[model samples]
Target: MLVKDMMHPAVCVTPRDTLATAVRKLAHEHIGCLPVCDGMRPVGMLTDRDIAIRATAQGRDSNEVTVREVMSVGALCCSTTDPVEKAAQLMHLSHLRRLIVLDRRAHVIGVISASDINGFLSEPRPFEVVFYKEVLDHLGHTHRSQLMRISMAHGTREEAVRAAILEFEETRRVNHWNALADGYDVVSVRSNS
Candidate 1:
């Protein structure tokens, strides 16, 4: 299947739109993201996660904050004619649940969400998770960086995400694993699907 075959009409928002307005559209559409467009071209993507982390968490007034303030810049896009496998790969690598589908003219034509990909993730796959950490040095004056990577095979993405955090905290002997509260990236180590 191709992206164009499965993509639905994109519901877009402008950069200057307020977060409150965007949230309304998202709720009304029952969608997690909206393509942020300038005219017909997609400039960015505003996701529910973005709103929660960038605005709500920061205690900013949603009515005063603009989409451009919290929206993720440089929205990943796939050509409408591209194969569904390509879309799946992009989403898997980027940790995005949807991607903007563009036409030949580089116009926002529609959106291809994970749900739109037929059986793309029906089978189980091993995912690699990397945790970046900052630890205090022996002097207690400097911060040192460390990282750990783990492989997990969970039935669902949500399960994989939670499991990764739990495993990291337990294995690393850390009290809290708050770094991934916003989100984290994972790569499919192997896929049998």
Candidate 2:
């Protein structure tokens, strides 16, 4: 499936928004990330990690900060049509857990993460079952190892694997596969040609 298929629409933040407000929204909504937009165009992304690392780490009060202050600029993104595997690979390479989905003109359309993929895996579908092997194979060694580490650290193999996979998807490196399958046929052909 493509990012557009699963990404959350109605993405909720802009650069000028205050960190305090963002935090409140996040807490209220129980979400961990936000796409920072300039009007309708996405300019960056803000996450719980950015606030903890950039603001709290510096001893700054979140209440006084702007989303721009702690937001990651030039945020990794994916096109709506990009393959799910490609998104996963990007996440792994960048060590990121969320990615903003964009449209043909580079406008923010939605966001996708490992969580979405996990949800897809849990749902019953014939196509999903068939593609499962392809999905696993696309998640390369580094990605797999990262997932294992997360699993070990977090105490749940399933959750860890999902987190790792989603993290990579969010970073824009969606080309991962299970070791057994070689790689996605389309991706391999594009890389070679």
Clashes of each: 0, 27
CA-lDDT, candidates in order: 0.80, 0.66
Q: What would you estimate as the lDDT of candidate 2?
A: 0.66
Which digits, one per residue and each the tens of the lDDT, describe model 1 over residues 1-193?
Answer: 4689889899999999999999999999999899999999999999999999999999999999999999999999999876565677779989889999999999998999998774654544477666655556678774534466655545466666677777666544667776433334677766545
lDDT of 2 by residue, 1-193 (tens): 5678778874578777888989988898778888898876888888889999999889998778889889999889888886565676678789888899888998887888877776654443221111123223554533221222111122244443454455434442456534333222111111122
Q: Return the top candidate by TM-score.
A: 1
Badly placed stretches (over 4 Å) of model 1 are 118-193
Worst 10 residues of 1 by lDDT: 176-185
